[model samples]
Target: MTSASLLPSGLRAWAQRQVGPITAVRDVSRLRPGSRVWELSLDGGRPGVFLKAASGVVAYQRESFAYRHAVPALGPQAAPQLVESSARHLALLLTAIPGRPLAALDVPRAARYEAYRQAGVLLGWLHAAGDLRGEHRVEAGEALQCAARGVEKRLTAAGDRVRAAERRLVLRLAGDLLRLGPLPLGFLHGDAWERNLIWSGRTGWVDFSRARFGACVQDFVPMYCTAWAEDPGLRAAVLRGYGRELSSEEEYALMCLSALDAVGCLAWGVPNGDHALVERGRAVLARLEAQAV
Candidate 1:
C-alpha cells in the first residue's frame, strides 16, 4: 500500500481531477524495479484506475497513443481504457482490466493454450486496428532496410558481450531479411510476450510502451523465444487463433527476427545482471543454430 502523500503532488492532483478523489493507492509494479505503477481506489466506489508513471516522454507518448488508437480495436474487454493523461507529469490513468499476468498464472496446459489462443486473437485485432494509409504506412522495402539497420546497430553496441558465433548468426539473419523482399507492415505491440498478457477468464493485453508500426511478424518474436520455442503446439494454437498460418516469407521473417531478439536479450541482460534474460537469449540462439544446421 502507498500513501497519497508519497505520490508527486502534481500527479496526484491531476489524477484526482480526472477520476475524483482517490481513496487509496497500492503499488503494483512488478518485473521492473522502480517503475511507478499503482492501483487506485476511488471514493464513491467508482471503478478502480491504474496509474503508470512513464520513465520518459517517449515511452509515455507511445503508450498513451496506443491506448488511444490501437487497443480499442480489441474491444473494451481485451485491454485497459485510457481514463485520462497528464502530459506534464508523464502519467496515464487507465481503467483497470481484470486478470493476473499469464506468466504468473499456474494452469493446466489446455488452459494455457486457450489463453495464448485468445492472446493471438487480440493481437490480430490490434494489428488490424487502423487503416495504414498516409503516414501510418511504411513502405515495405524501407521498413526492411530500417530493420536491418537496427539489427546492425544493436549488434555493434553489444560488441564483445555478443559471442563470436552469436555475432555471426545475427549478421547472417539480418542478411537473410534483406533478401526476403517486402513484408506486411502494421501496428505492433513491440513487446508482446506472456508476461505482458493477462489471463483470468480470457487474455487481456497490457503495456504498450514499445508499440509502433512495423513488420507484423516482429510481434511474435517474444513468444517465439519462449512458448513457441518450447512447444510447437502452442505455436500452432496461437497462429490458428490469429486466423491463419504465416506465409513462407513470413515464416522466414520470424526466424530472422528471432535471431535479432536473441542477441538483444543477451546484450541487455548481461550488463544488467538479469540471468533469466541472458539464458533465454542463449536458448533462442541454440535453437537458431540447430535450425541452421
Candidate 2:
C-alpha cells in the first residue's frame, strides 16, 4: 500500500527514509487498543522489523528514551532491539522478536504458569542490572499516594461497604508503607501485566513507555493479585525464579500495592465500560481486604 495511505504523513516518511528504497508497510496491528504497531517488509523479501508509533508526542519521547536507555540493561534478548527512533516524529523501528504474547487468557494453564516463572526470572535479572540513570524516579511514598488518589477518586460511585472497606484499606496500607521505611529502588516495568510480555525462545518485555524507577516489589504486585492468587504453584515458582521469598516487610508492602492496583483497575474499567474488568477488580479488592486482616 502507499505510505501516505498506510501511516500518518510524518511517520510514513520517517519509516520509508529509515528502511530505504522499496520499503512497504505490509500489515498494521494494535498491540493494545490505541497502541500502534506495524509490520514492515524491506528490500523485497528480506525479513523485516516491527514499528511502534505513538499518537501523542510525550508518549513518543518516553518510549523512545526507554527503549534506548532501559532495554539494554535487561540483557541482549530481553526485549526487541531499538533500531531507529525519533521523538519528534513519534515513531520507532525495532527488531521483531518472534513470539506470541503471554496473555493469561490465551495460553494453556501449564504454559501460562511456566511463563510466569520465566517472567519472574527476567524481572530478577532486570532488577539486578544496577540502577538505570535518567529515568523518572517515583519514590515509595509518592507511589502509594498516587495509588491512593486513584482509589479515592472512584469511591463516590461505590456502595457504602466498598467505600468504607477501601478507605480503611487505603489508610492502613499507607501506614504500612510508611513503617516499612525507604525501600530498595530500581527500574520498574511500570506495566508488568501478562499482556505486556511476549514468550518466544525466552520472555521478552515490551511497551517501555511506562517504565520508571521505583520499589522492586511494585513490579510484581499485579501478578501477585491475579496469577499468583489463582495458582499457588505459580506463586511459588515465580518466587523460586526470583531467588528469594519476600521478607515480612516486603510482603506487607506488596499487599498494599496489590490493593491499590486493584482499585486502579476498577477505575479504569468503569470508564471504559468493561463490565468483566470492573467485576474482576472488585473481586480482587475484596480478596486483598481479607488478606490484610
Candidate 3:
C-alpha cells in the first residue's frame, strides 16, 4: 500500500549470498499497519523470501535471538524459519503461512467456535513452550523489563502529552500500571495483537520482535485485550487449551504489562495526535481491578 524504501544495505548483501542474487524484490507494502514485510525473489526464482526490517540495532539483535530459540523447537510448521539475519535485517525463508488475519475473521453471531478452538490449540503450544526454564530462555526477562522501562520513559519524556485531552485512555491505562500482580518468567510473544495471528485452517503467529522471556500473562494480553474482549466466552476455549482458567495472578501480571504496552504506544503515537490512549489504558486497568480474586 505504502512503500518507503525500507531495504537494509548490509542485510541485502547477506541475502544475495545466502539465497542467491535478488533478481526481483516485490514491495508488499500493501500489508497495513505495523512493519513492512517484503517478498524477495532471489536469482529471480520461485518461493521468494519474506523479509522484515528491524527498527534499529537493539530490536534487530533481540529478534535475532528469538529466531535462534524458536525455530528448532517449534519446527517448520510453527514460526517463520530464519534464513539469514544481521544487524539491520532478519530474513525468514519459511513456507508461507496460509490464511487471513484472525482479527478479520467474521462471525456475525458473535461466536466463532472454530476460530476460538484453533486459537486455543496454538496458544497452548506457545504458553507451554514459552516457559523460561529451558536453555531457550534468552533475554526473556530483559524483554519484559524493556517493555516496562520503555513505557515509563515515554510517559516521563512525553509528560506534556500524557495530559492532553485526547490521550485520556493512554493516561488511564498508565495509572493502572501500579496494581499489576505477580508472575513467573517464560518465553512470550511480547506483542500478541490479533493481526499477528494468521488463520487459515489453523492459526500461525509471526513477528518475533517482542518475543522474549517474561510473565506468562504477557503472552495472553493481546489475545484478551484486542481479540477476546468483546466475547469473553471465548476465554473458556483458550483456557481449555491451557487446561486452566486465566489465573488471577496471570491476569494481574498481564494487566500491568498491557498497561505498559498501551501507554508506551500512546507515547510513541504522539506524533499522530491520537486521543484514544487513555481509554485503552483504562480498559486494561479495569480488567485487572475487577477480576481481583
Which predicted model would earn the best lDDT? 1
TM-score of 1: 0.94
Please give the clash total of every predicted structure, in order.
Answer: 0, 0, 14
Candidate 1 C-alpha lDDT tens digits along 56-164: 9999988998888888888767899899887889999998888889898889999989998998898898888856777678542366667766987788767787778
Q: Which residue pairs in candidate 1 have backbone atoms (N, alpha carbon, C) closer than 3 angstroms, thus clashing?
A: none
Model 1 stretches with alpha carbons more than 4 Å out: 1-5, 139-141
Task: State every prediction's TM-score relative to the real structure.
Answer: 0.94, 0.84, 0.74
Query: Order of all candidates by lDDT, from best down to worst?
Result: 1, 2, 3
In model 2, the worst 10-residue window by lDDT is: 132-141
Model 3, C-alpha of 242: deviation from truth (Å): 2.7
> What lDDT score belongs to each candidate, Candidate 1 first?
0.83, 0.70, 0.60
RMSD of 2: 3.5
* Candidate 2 vs. true structure, TM-score: 0.84
Writing each residue's lDDT as its tens digit, candidate 2 over 1-293 gives: 54433656666678778876536665555433566777877886766887787768767765776677667766656687788998776788987765777874466667766777778887787665534444344443356555545555655544353566676776577556655666666667777877778887467787777666677788888677776777889888788777888777778788877766666666667767767667767877788767665
Off by over 4 Å in 2: 1-6, 26-33, 55-58, 104-110, 130-162
| Position 71, candidate 3: lDDT | 36
